[model samples]
Target: MNYRHVYHAGNFADVVKHVALVAILLHLKKKDAGFAVLDSHAGRGVYDLTGEEAARTGEARAGVARLMDLRDEMPPALATYLQLVKEGGPARYPGSPLLAARLLRTQDRLTAIEKHPEEFAALKDALAPYANAAVENGDGYARAVKLLPPPSRRGLVVFDPPFESPDEFETLAQAIRDAVRKFANGIFLIWYPIKSQAAADAFTGEVLAGGVQKALTVDTQISAPEGNLDRAGLLVINPPYGFDVEMYAAAEILAPLLRADIAVKWRAGTP
Candidate 1:
């Protein structure tokens, strides 16, 4: 569907994805050990909500705007994610790169990949403040494998694809599988839209059948997929011990406030 992330900048899908991304990265940072972050399909890194595309639909109004509007009453986890967004005002949205760079330690490095030349330039500019970041303009699906096990062998890979095609799902699953085989200790966070229950189910099946240890699938939907963007999800491989609990609490706290019929579900296969 030629889904450009620009139009959907701070929408519910972005909310679900970025919140989970921040949560995972934060958990990884809790330890004294340094870790690297590999962001594949990382969009321009930061988005201006006041821009033409964002102003056109004002999607953030119902997405991140709603979250910020309810910030004071949210649980700690939800609060943490919203805190970052609120920092930049409703006019700017922090994409994955900005999120990671904000929380990463000096020793922690970040590798961001964006294929679109224009967006890649924006991504580079957005990440310029961080001395530890490296921006690559290319197809991340290929780079993820090529850059497996980052330098530290301790890190998380963030996959936030535009999902222009369904085949991208299989490719994402395979890349995670390949990465895990190469760096068994690293974590992988993959974001996807919940267009159909069947699609979500199929992706979950792929993760389980791949024999990935400590895998979790957390999904949130505001409505049944019927003519509108209805849901968002994150597939977490090797998540930290208590991450699912935090994610559950965040979802519960966010559902009612952000409700378009938002529902949260999660499952872990014998990790």
Candidate 2:
């Protein structure tokens, strides 16, 4: 419950996660029908990169900071993400909820849930400008199941949990199963830290064993897994068509820039 994203906003994982996020949202927009987005574990919607929390870690320096100078070199999907970050201003970084809100169309809707009270208040205010967006103070995982099969019948659910609990993997595995059962067609994206290869593999196995038909696992490692925070990944369930091709291209460019090893693979079905 003590986990806060302020210190880690705009870090490398955020870059990978948000790049894919923008790509998915763009895909959803291709159709004339409106869609909904549920940001489970939504943090404070926006963050000040210069604030004490960010300053303490300075993680963005190695992440978003490095990309700021190479805007012309980024691929289409990444360029879009970079543009969003640039719009947030040099010292400001938009979290997932804010990013979704900015990209949402008038016909679209967004529901962001943050369990932490302080973060929830910040999220509510940050999303207030969007009439189509709503903020709720509650457990995001639980909220995910309840909000599935949105009235739009087309939506995306992002699970960016703070894996502070030892059983987080198991918890997330079940959550994925439940979410898929409630809304099989909905896109589900999960962000996880790779502290140990064995644990990560086991977690992936558990999720696959839950009977999901299509899943993709993409990960980037800035360095060898010598510590707990060197690597991160995203497990995407029921991704949009051509998403893997586009994401692989983005990952190729991102890994070199960040000095990381990038691995993109389909866990359940062909791209």
Q: TM-score winner among the candidates?
A: 2
Best by lDDT: 2
RMSD of 2: 1.5
TM-score of each predicted structure versus truth = 0.91, 0.96
Model 2 CA lDDT for position 269: 75
Look at candidate 1 and give me any clashing residue pairs: none
The residue ranges of model 1 lying beyond 4 angstroms of the native Cα positions read 71-76, 224-226, 260-266
Model 2 error, position 128 (Å): 0.6
State each model's CA lDDT, in order. 0.78, 0.88
Considering only N, C-alpha and C atoms within 3 Å, which residue pairs clash in candidate 2? none
What are the per-residue Cα lDDT tens digits for candidate 2 across 1-271? 6688987888888889999999999899999899999999999999998788787787777778888877456666788888889998856698999989999999999999999999999999999999999999999899988889899999899999999898998898888889889898899989999888999999889888877888999888885334337799899999999889889889888888788887889999776
Residue 82, model 2: lDDT of 89
